[model samples]
Target: MSNRGRDTRTARSRWSLFGPIVAVGTALAVIPLWLDHSGVLMGVAVLGLAFACYAIGFNVIFGSTGQLFLCVGALAGIGGYGGAILADTVGLPVVVSILLATLVSCVTGGLLSLIAVYRSLGVIFTGIITLIFTLTFDALLLGLGSLTGGENGFLIKAGADTFLRKRIPPYYVMLALVVAFLLLHGLLRRSHVGWAWRALRDDELAAELAGIDVARYRVYGALVGAAMLGLAGATYAFTEGRVSPTTFGFAQVDVVVLVMLAFGGIGTLLGPVLGAATFTIVDEILIEFGQLRLVIYGALVLLLFLFLRRGVIPTARDFVAKRRLSQASAAPD
Candidate 1:
């Protein structure tokens, strides 16, 4: 086959993979119709979307550029508290506050990435740096209780009268954010940015030798991902009408987000959404177990790691590819 033909085939195959993801992802919009009668379930769905947003952003940083950002919750907390302070204390509009908070997260993420690159820190060291930051953020939340409401958190008065607090509207709002995050990832995956990320992730040294700006691309991934995390956290906090240290605590939020992305198939576009949906339901079911929830969680995590290490999506893709290849090899051709 000609080089042009091969390139065209590769592009077509790449896009075809997203057809299912986009279809199912957007189909989440109609979830309200089914759960309209149950505010509790609908609320869970909204939380699921928020988690999905975090996982997607994490994927961009970790899956794309090999940055193990252990402080997903800390960065997201920045957005949540940032939004609360700006909207309530500073008297900014809710939308404006959320946007500004997202930018703050973006800048923070970029700075972290830049520092890692400048210091030539490996993945583990970079994670340690972010983990310390997370611990400090948790401390600040308590030490500066007047502004953050300390341990108890505070109500969101700014958007209370808006539809944002409505049970169904907030779900749709978060759903929209998830779709937009997915779309953004798709755009990056198709562009030269995606190319740089693939190269950088696969082999940083080779990527540098091949003329890719490793530092710049790494920073780009973090900035975009952190923006998504911030926007999701801030918007969800305001809509839920509460902001507390526990809301974005590393143990509560970051651990769950990590599990979701890992189970979803990190680099794949739909992994975060798929993983979030699966775990959200799993969590709801685990609620019935009361005290055994932790045990069940451990069991489930063990099973996931043992059987689906590459995650549901990547493993399934590998299976389908192998089947097709075998059939082609056995054919008359």
Candidate 2:
């Protein structure tokens, strides 16, 4: 194909891919306005947004940086606990506690990354270590009963404002947070640090040779990702008005992090948002089926994986790009 033709085809393909996203965003913004239970609907929308944030954070480390982390739930719990503890025990404002939780989660991520890098562990080993850390943290929380409230969990005090108590307030806060975190993702993806992360994912030794400081970049990615997770956790706790160690168990972590990533297409930016929305809707609606819901959900996910190997967005983008390339090649000289 001629260069001109190829460029035109590529431009068209990019526009085609982005068009759907714009349409979807329009729908999301408009739908809430018309819903009968606007508050509940908005709350669900906010929860989906929160999940998207958490998934994107995971994407940075696991998808972009090629790290295997399994303590997603534990880290989120740490964030929630940190926020709740500060809000309740130390009398910090909810907003301050939430910010503090994010910082703490960053610290936690840094410590975990340090251990991973220092040990020179492979992916599987890192996964195992993370799993161990998650389990140990759960045990510690259970043992620390007084602080964590053990299995019973801790209660969060609602904000003083009456309007803040309404479900819509939480939804708005979460939506704002999701937007902020996602904006950060977009900025980071275009930055030097983001490219370094992709390079590290491509080849650690080569990235090291290129003076990318692979370990530092990896740690930074982890910290950034953890910050997002922490924000999600803190927001979730505040919105729910409570938190428990049980909330961050292995299953919840695996389901939210892995399932959402798988559904969203890990490498691409839109995958998490799309995946979280679809998964949340599916989960919510399927609850009516009782015992069969889980079975059906698992089956659907398996089928999706089998057919859409790269998850939804990646697979679609690949398809679009390939088609555009073909069209370019077939164009008249």
lDDT top scorer: 1
| Predicted candidate 1 versus true structure: per-residue lDDT over 65-170, tens digit per residue | 8999998998999999999999999999999999999999999999999999999899999999999989999999999999989999977799999999898999
Give the clashing pairs for model 1: none
User: lDDT tens string, model 2, 1-333?
Assistant: 555687788787666555555555555655566653766666667667777778888887788777788888888888889899998888998889989988998888878988898887888998999889899989998999999898999987745454545656666666666666666766677689889988888889999999998888888888988888888888787777778876677776656668888888986777887888888898789878999987997898789888887898877878899999999899956
Quantify all predictions' global Cα lDDT against the true fold. 0.90, 0.79
Candidate 2 Cα lDDT to native: 0.79
Superposed Cα deviation of residue 69, candidate 1 (Å): 0.5
Q: What lDDT score goes with residue 175 in model 2?
A: 62
Clash number for model 2? 0
Best by TM-score: 1
Q: Which stretches of candidate 1 lie over 4 Å from their true place?
A: 1-18
Q: Whole-model lDDT, candidate 1?
A: 0.90
